[model samples]
Target: MKKLLAECLGTFTLVFAGTGAIVINAATHGSITHVGIALVFGLVVLAMIHTFGDVSGAHLNPAVTLAFAAARRLPWREAPGYVVAQVAGAFAASLLLHFLFPQDTTLGATLPLGSDAQSFVLELVLSAILMLTILSVSTGAKEKGITAAITIGGVIALEALFAGPISGASMNPARSLAPAFISGHLSHLWLYLTAPILGALLAVPLCLCVRDSTCCCASPTSGKS
Candidate 1:
């Protein structure tokens, strides 16, 4: 219960602050550029991780939660509830942002449908990288190095640089879904969900394939003496 609530609020913060920056930037002539938008998204994730990380692991994206499940870091039973909470919180934040900034049509939303396939493919690939990096940095094996925060933020900034102009670089399903509904634009919703989820799912196997078996706990063998 507390964990779910934390996940909800954390996700809401990510979309609200990050996309809200988009709305504000678009409304102003030169106040904030693409770089600024990317910064907002990255910084929001950084702050939120430090905020709700200890409680809920700050998984603001369904894709992320699913990835953790796939990696066996999170129990499968808890995923559905976490995803629901995250989506609800995101949509609520979107509604608030819409109410606050009615003049900004973009509202820091994801890219529209019919965008070039070249860009879409890039978004998908980069999104996968983002998920993979998140899993790697946040896992118990690596979190001990105090690199989780920095690594996740760095990956976000790097992916944003790659995908910001193309498909809005959204590796987060909840972040994309809320604004789409609030703005009444369902364009490319599939890409936003499919690409990120697929990317995140792919990370599970990819991480396992590269993980050092020696670092993991050894199993007891009955026949061994």
Candidate 2:
């Protein structure tokens, strides 16, 4: 229960601060700016990891939780609980955002700036990179501590900065889902849900390349969990 609460609150805070930046920037007529919004996402992730990483690995993103499970660092049985917590937290944040800024159309929902295929590809690449970084920095079964936080946060920041104009750089399904769901802007929701999971899963094989094969493909009894 403590772990679940930690995961929920961490995810809630992540969506609140990160998506809040987007809503605020729009409300204030770009006062936060694109770079500032990206910074908010990164900083919030850093803060959350520092806050809850020890308890639940700070997996605020469902794709991330799934990726860890795929890499055998987490148990499959635990994945659903984490994903549910993350989605719940994200919806909580989205509902609050809707109440706070009702007039905003998208409510920070990510939409493709160009073709849907382009956004799909970008999201896949972005999530793959993000998951790869998470796996690389994580120590043992934990994705916590200073190094993990900074490196993962940095990767998110960089991805958002470079790709926000194109695909909104949403590497997390929950991040994209909450706002799209509440705002009725779910036209491209499928891309987000499928791309990120595929991208995160793709990182598993990549991890095997640089690290010991056991590090990424461990079984339940291989000491990963």
Candidate 3:
């Protein structure tokens, strides 16, 4: 139950803040550029990691959690609970955004069906890099020995700046899911889901290799191994 709650709250923090950035991005009327949105989004992840990473690894994204599950970093039984919590948290955030900003049409969600294929592929690649960085910094090799909050936040910030324009840089399935629920668009939902998962999947082995390198004193198992 504690783990489930942790997942729920962590996901809530992610969607609430991430989607909030989208709201800011659109409503700011050019005040908040892509860089600004990415920064805010990254900060949100950084903050939540400190608050919830210890309890549930702060896996606010279904894709990230799923990757961990596939790698056996997390139990399979917990996957559904985590995904459910993530989706529900995202949905609740969306509802609140709807209430607070009822007049706004966009929910700060992601869709790539109509977007250029090249752009979509670029987004996927960027997302992979971000996920791999998160795995490395948070887990092993380049653990950096920094606080989880700072490291994850920095990762998110970089990802946002580079990938926000392409595919909305939605490396998170839950982040994309919430907006789709409210905005009534599922056209490219699969792209967001599949691409991010693939990115995460690729990161698993690469992170393993990097973490195994003898640059650090700690063993690979110490981090995400």
lDDT of each: 0.76, 0.89, 0.72
Tens-place lDDT digits, model 3, residues 1-225: 665687788778778777787786677786777787888888888877777776667788887777666555566666788889888888888889888888777688775534657555765686678777666655421223447568778877887776666678788888887788788877777777777778877777776677764322332242322
RMSD of 2: 1.7
Weakest 10 consecutive residues, lDDT, candidate 2? Answer: 216-225
State the lDDT at 91 in candidate 2.
97
Which is the winner by lDDT between candidate 2 and candidate 3? 2
Clash counts per candidate, in order, are 0, 0, 0
**Model 3: colliding residue pairs:** none
lDDT tens digits by residue: candidate 1, 98-117: 89988777666688434657
Over 1-225, each residue of candidate 2 has an lDDT whose tens digit, in order, gives 676788889999989999999999999999999999999999999989899888778889999988888887888888888899999999999999999999999989999999999999999999999998999888555774588899999999999999999999999999999999999998899999999999999998998998887887665432323
Question: In what order do the candidates fall by TM-score, top score first?
Answer: 2, 1, 3
Off by over 4 Å in 2: 219-225
Which structure is stronger by TM-score: 2 or 3? Answer: 2
lDDT winner between candidates 1 and 2: 2
Please list the residue runs of candidate 1 whose C-alpha ends up more than 4 Å from where it truly belongs after superposition.
Answer: 112-116, 140-145, 213-225
What 10-residue stretch in candidate 1 is worst by lDDT? 216-225
Q: TM-scores, in order shown?
A: 0.89, 0.96, 0.85
